[model samples]
Target chain A: MYGKKVKLRIFFFSIIFLAILLTTFLILKSLEENVVYFISPSDVKVLPELSKKKIRIGGMVKKDSIETNAKEILFIITDYKSEIKVSFSGSIPNLFAEEKGVVAEGFLKDRNYFTAKKILAKHDENYMPPEVKKALESKK
Target chain B: MFNIFSPSKIFSITSRATKYVFAIFILIISVGLIEALFLSPKDYIQSDSVRIMYVHVPAAWISLGIFSLIALLSISILIFKNKTFSLIAKSLAPSGFIFSIIALVTGSIWGKPTWGTWWAWDARITSMLILGLFYLMYIVAWRVISPNNANKVTSIIAIIGVVNIPVIKFSVDWWSTLHQPSSINILSKSTIHHSMLVPLIIMTAAFALFSLLIFLMKYNTELIKIKNKGLDRL
Candidate 1:
């Protein structure tokens, strides 16, 4: 009976192990199942016949060329190699300035501007304190 | 055989000391975070989000460090059948899992402000998630296997599974993704000033010590279980 009890204890723990693994799987699948991988115009060298899948493009806002309409805001991003125009319909970030490194996610409707659902700013590697960050913000 | 204060007691003595160590660690972490967040000088550009570095970088560092320690603990058990080593591995698993959780949560919080979206399937995050899952499995392995065989089986798994850690680190560079490479690892071009790096280093050290303290406490509990088993046999 003692041996049996020990074995029973181990069996119960095995179920716990399965439960944690299942939880991890559910969480990761939820995170990845929806994200669309897009590419930049300069990086979009292949220009594959991608018509069905959604994608994202990343680069910089071309200098002094941001155009805004009531419907959309359009700008070009460059990887220092080539540039691609991106049209975003959402509230653009203040840091989404001209000639800074950026990454945007969305689908391309034409060769002109890729419609962006999301835009990300790639700053320097380190985090700055708020006062210094405010200084930079004030300059902008 | 159970000499409470024998030479074997060094391990036990250190286990008790971990509580003091961890308390001091928490103090250091809070001081470091406070300095970095409110008191320290800010960046030339990024304002508030720059403060995310205090939390994000340390959590990320701990996630990987825990796994490497697990591998080391596992190897010591498998190769030498070291009893204390297995105890250490079992205790380390939950903390590693916690650190991974911290890294993911802090990263997501940082992401919302900088990336516009709350989440991204970037290379580094993906690998970090995988590392977290691996940690869960390692802990589960410890719980399921027989105490005797758990040591052997988990040790083997830890040694074999370590291959994934490096793969997770380099996956960003290998595959094009939104996540960038090691910030400090890059030359002085991307270097953070000493003022910023000091707080980060202190936080990292504090976190490591804190994890070790928890590990010692956990080990003491498991040692009790082992001692009880011997009593049962008698």
Candidate 2:
């Protein structure tokens, strides 16, 4: 059993704790735009002006839209509603493939074309063996 | 209720229990390693590199879980003014810090193979880095401050640090991070298959036991210090 002093202390601490939590929440909420790591192609579509500054465009690698050469690789990133053509000279990640998620960091040349300085693959949370994945694919 | 948590009683009980905990930890970890390394199904995409998830996920979970526990204990310390609670919180910190480091390092390694980079300034990863820094600050507070001041200072540090826990948990959901969203959900069906989930659960249990072992050892040392100082109560 707690004494009166302890109960008062508990109440006081809870108030302080809640205050701190609220302050943190507000700070993070205000900085929401800065915290977003990348923007999707759908987001890029409505951009009023194209800038030279580097930006990251993230979306799925469009199915059957990748073309490769010894000097560079070209791929179309699509968020279903919109698509951006990305040209990258750098090495692509192993996970980069058709219909898989990818993020390209570079400059947007126009509304439709992006020149990428780097490519990073993004994989989904799903995990399964090759055989099971094959079975799922077949069923689909 | 407080009588059962007296330093001498806890020290003796923990000292006796340590061996059994260690044995269980070793047994569980051995099986966990085998299951995680060999038995678990490889990812359809990432393949064997997905095995890193066994270590990375468990370490992150334990670090997050321990920080939350310490924060709760910190609140108890403030409310009850109990030395035992402070001791438990203090003893719990080192493992939390260690596991946070392990999580960060393992995540980096896992990231390189899968995400194609060792590091990213993404929201989820950045928030996790902040959590690790908070753990560092909490440990430093204990070492730098005097005993009487340490309890209050460390408790405040923990209480403040705990606000980041939810930030880390929800960062992926809230932001357009390079990291994928969570697969394991409590309220709904998990995306991860059963074969992988079983090993993950086993590894998490093993990691929990290992942290418990570390806590008991540290707690016992603190109790011995109290005894050596000739203080009968904590």
Off by over 4 Å in 2: none
Residue-level lDDT for B214 in candidate 2: 99
Model 1, which residues run further than 4 Å from truth? A1-38, A126-140, B1-7, B186-190, B231-234
lDDT of 2 by residue, A48-112 (tens): 77878899999999999999998899999999999999999987889999999999999999989
For residue B3, give model 1's deviation from the true position in Å. 14
Counted clashes in each candidate structure: 9, 0
Q: Cα RMSD for candidate 1?
A: 8.1
Q: Give all candidate RMSDs, comma-separated.
A: 8.1, 1.2
| Model 1: per-residue Cα lDDT over A34-128, one tens digit each | 33233667656557565545677776678987898999888888777877778888876545777776787787777555778877865435454
Give the lDDT of residue A31 in candidate 1: 53
lDDT (10s digit) by residue, model 2, range B55-170 = 98999999999999999999988888877899999999999999999999999998998889999999999989998999999999999999889999999999999999988999
| Candidate that scores best on TM-score | 2
Best by DockQ: 2
Q: Evaluated with lDDT, which candidate comes out highest?
A: 2
Error of 1 at B165 (Å): 1.8
- The ten-residue window of minimal lDDT in model 1 chain B covers B1-10
Per-residue lDDT of model 1, residues B1-234, tens digit only:
223423236455866787688788889878887877777676655566667777778877887887888888765454444576666777888877898888888888877766655677776777788788888878888788886578878866665556567656766555556665566775446457666888788878877887878877787777677666674211
| All candidates: DockQ | 0.18, 0.86
